[model samples]
Target: MPEYTTGKPWRLSAFPPLLWAVALLLTLSLAYAAQSGATYILIDDNLDTELAPPYALLQEGKALDYRSTTRVDRLMNGLPRNALRPGLQPLVGLMALFPPLEAYLLHELLVRLAGLLGMYLLLRRYGLPGPRLAALCAGLALAWAVLPAYTAYGVSVLGQPWVALALLNLRRGPGRWSDWLVLVVFAFWSSLVLAGMFVLAAAGLLLLRDTWRHRRIAWRPVLGLLVLGISYGVVEYPLVYSLLVKRQFVPHRLEFDYARLAPGGVGVGLASAGRYLLLGQYHAGLFLRAAPLLAAGLALAYAPAGAARRRLLRKLLAGVGVLVGVALFCGFYPQLIGVVQQTVPPLRAFNLSRFHFLTPLLWFGVLAFSLRHLPGPGLRAALVGLQLLLGLGMNTEWTLNVRRLLGRLPATEPTYAAYVAPELFRRIRQDVEARTGQQPARYRVACLGFAPAVASLNGFYTLDAYQNNYPLAYKHQFRELIAGELARSPELRTYFDAWGNRCYLFSAELGKNFRVAALPERAVAHWAFDARSFRRLGGRYVLSAARLLHPEASNLRLLGEYAAPGAYWHIWLYEVR
Candidate 1:
């Protein structure tokens, strides 16, 4: 990789004034579209559940809870009855160490802003010619304008782009101390997968002899990074706790079973690799369509100035190596794949071609590096055309796949203004106050008839979708049914409480007639309880009476149905008591 930078220093002109105008337009367009539900539409639902809890949590101002405390207690005894714990994430606690809500919001913002910044960084890093950079930037804007995940992660915000920007500036100069601080912050808070990739890339650079020689070896920066990383790790006590104690490896059905490790694993590896490659057969087939461009770029490299040739080769090799490593690891290591699958639970829930993202980044980098050698305008135009054609022929399925991914998301019915009519949650809260005489306290609320979107709206604790398996249930009945089996067994609860959860947020219809001897003696006025319907869904009962309360009157009224457009399951929210 160090060898690749030996070319004539590519000088980038400031973006043309006209290009700035275009960039502005693209930004505004993307921002608007994102606000219009495009962002939610863009995520790869299967492998991208990272957005769900955060999105729900941010909207609700609360953390996850269980509908059935008995079920949860059976699952994890150490878990607090009603304290905010990090969601099913183990790698993210570092970021959340500072202030989970702030870090999470920052992460969301960074992903949103990365769209523009990624283009700018890519342009500045390679020193693309003004016109070319302008074109590329404009293209990126437009591409992302329609791209949903761009907004979903808040890419238009500051997250991914900030990292790229930090790297670019770091390469330009060590940068201000503030810059280092920000990078350290992002490293902890950003997607752990992306952070892991960055760590590997940095490791790769540190390994390169040329890099070690050309770059001053300083213990200070390294120490700074270490200190920062450690600080983050410490702060993310929840993550550290989980990693050190809670997380365990399990053989998910879809992923490879590494327990059968053998010396003949290469054949097994290749077969597994090919299966994933062929899984998204359409896009994978089209990815092959970039071969000609890769070839042509190589052809140009041969005649190129020796320095450029060597430089391009280094980048190519590193990119290829990393990509291959990612593929192989994902294919062969059941543990690695299982861990990633846990982060994006839906990937296991829905069988998707999780590797599709790699192809685009791989080809784009290769193609971008190759652009330096083109003879002139005609050649560059041809190269650009090839790229466009490749993109067009490429995965048109990203959008649809994103929707599919969103659909499979366990319906985390986080309360959002969008979930019900705007301000409806507030209105309901006011109504509760009017009827009940006491203002709601900082406590978890139960949605008697539906999933609680209350967390999203009232900024109070609420239940998780996994707690409502029966409401969202179709085929993945195993996790829930197994829990149900354990629910009735006191012996099982003793062992289950090790995981730190105890509540289950079930649709009232699912746990019908399940007796809860601990219903609060005092109920808030105006909240209704229909024993029949309550039993139909798992009956809504609080596990910890001191921490939970029910309404005296059954004025359970419709707040709003949770929004689940193109979603796989019905998600509704109701306000009771």
Candidate 2:
């Protein structure tokens, strides 16, 4: 391995002035669009439930109830009702400066820029210079910016670039006491950045190995890393307490099928990784699409280069190996997967496929390095042009998907408006306010068979909030209710995992009282509504998209009906007496 000069400042001097100008222009354009009320794409399950509450509290001029005001938080018994990543709190706090929609767009833009900068730094550290470095950085920035994954992923995707940045910083050992300070600070920051522990762990281990091989045992940096790890634990105390002390954390079952554990399973796992790496689209043509870039990158790696370049290539290859190995292990090994699920409750929620983010970074590095050795200047320029074109094409695909998912909303509309029609919510809020004289918080509303985030978006307190992390007490109560329902009605179909967590299929009887239209086959969970139980839990109103099919129960009185757009289901309101 070739040695790098320690203590070199992370500078942009190597990039051309024009590249900087273009980056600034792109950022400004994004900022302008956000300011103009562009509808953002946020399809992740917790995008609204987990993220919107704190921002809403901030907007209301209240201290961020770290235990968010959502129903999930209310049910939990913990110091910080929400498991907040300490590093990301500052970014979340920054969201208070703008409207929720604008805040989301701005945050996405900044993180994407950070990702681009990190990629540039990593390529620079790998010894790419001048126009080759510039071209590679631009290509990476464009490709990442256009990827469809971020549209559905929201802020969680920020972890990808953060991991890249951490890896880049790790490449250079501390030369000064201040460098040590920088490194330590970065370590702490990383802990709070993302929940994707696998990628972070892989990067940290690779860096440690590289450092050990390059220098005498650096106890100071090692100790700093240890301190950072401890600090992260301290910051995540609420989560730790919930999982270890309170035993409130429950691991979700893995999404993949474990039955195909042999050759077929292995093939499926590899194909799944390929899909994620290739942006989960254009699956049939993925290899064909990536062929040129892959060929050029492999050629560059094989060509003669300096010791430093070769070392960088080796490091990247090792990193990819670690990621791929871990992904396969999680994919094919059911027993191991079960163990991880049972032991690491927090990590169980992560989809193994997301680790594909790591592979692309290494591949992009290879592409960057290859650009320098691609025969003539003309050929290199052509490759760069091709990359840029590919990026544009990817971005176009992302835009179309966004439009399709969000309907007729302009790209400049607030995203919340698209998901929860502003007019419909306004009408509902207006009626509720008039009925209760403007204070909707006095009574909690239950959105039967609708996403709980809808209530949060419209500024109403709700009885239902969707999230994986719920209090043990709530889960217990829910399970008991499902159990009682099953015992009373033998015909009701339900499925329970080995863990005893149950998902009850919506029965005709259950559907008659509650809106169960458009739900999955086994849509009703242990937490599905029981009118008497909900009434005891302080639910005073129920808003549903489907009409109640059963005769009015003694407790539920139909209030009124509201029309919605032809594409949407009608809204029905009921007063839970």
Per-model TM-score, in order, reads: 0.51, 0.70
Q: Among all windows of ten consecutive residues in candidate 1, which has the lowest summed lDDT?
A: 70-79
Question: For candidate 1, what is the TM-score?
Answer: 0.51
Which candidate leads in TM-score? Answer: 2
1-577 per-residue lDDT for model 2 (tens digits): 1234587555556556337635653753342342223344443333445454454445444433334332222211111344433323434555667655666556556555555554555455553566445555555455544433342233233234444444344434533454344333443333332433544465567667866798755554455455555655665555555555764434333322223222355576676555444443221111113623463555545567788567656754664455456446545444445456556654444445334444545445556656655565566556655654565455533354346454654432234444555567778889888877856656767665455565566776665555443443444444432455555444442222222222221233354232232222222223234667656666677776555654154256778877545212356788766
Residue 563 in candidate 2, Cα distance off native in Å: 3.6
The digit string of per-residue lDDT tens for model 1 on 1-577 reads 1122665454434345335534553443332222322232221221123333343433333334322231221111111322222343322332335333234334434443454455455555553555445565444433322222322222212244444444545556666676576556554443332232344344345435435686765444445455446644643444444345653222122232223222245677676655443232231223443533464455455556687667766766776665566556546654444456657654442222334333434444455556555455555546555554454344333333233345542233221222332343454456555755545443334433222332332343343322201111211222342354346544433322222112233222223221111222212222223433333333222221111232233333343332234322222233433
Inter-residue clash pairs, candidate 2: 37-412, 38-412
Q: lDDT, candidate 1, residue 167?
A: 52
Backbone clash count, each prediction separately:
63, 2
**Candidate 2, residue 208: lDDT:** 76
Indicate the TM-score of model 2.
Answer: 0.70
lDDT of each: 0.38, 0.48
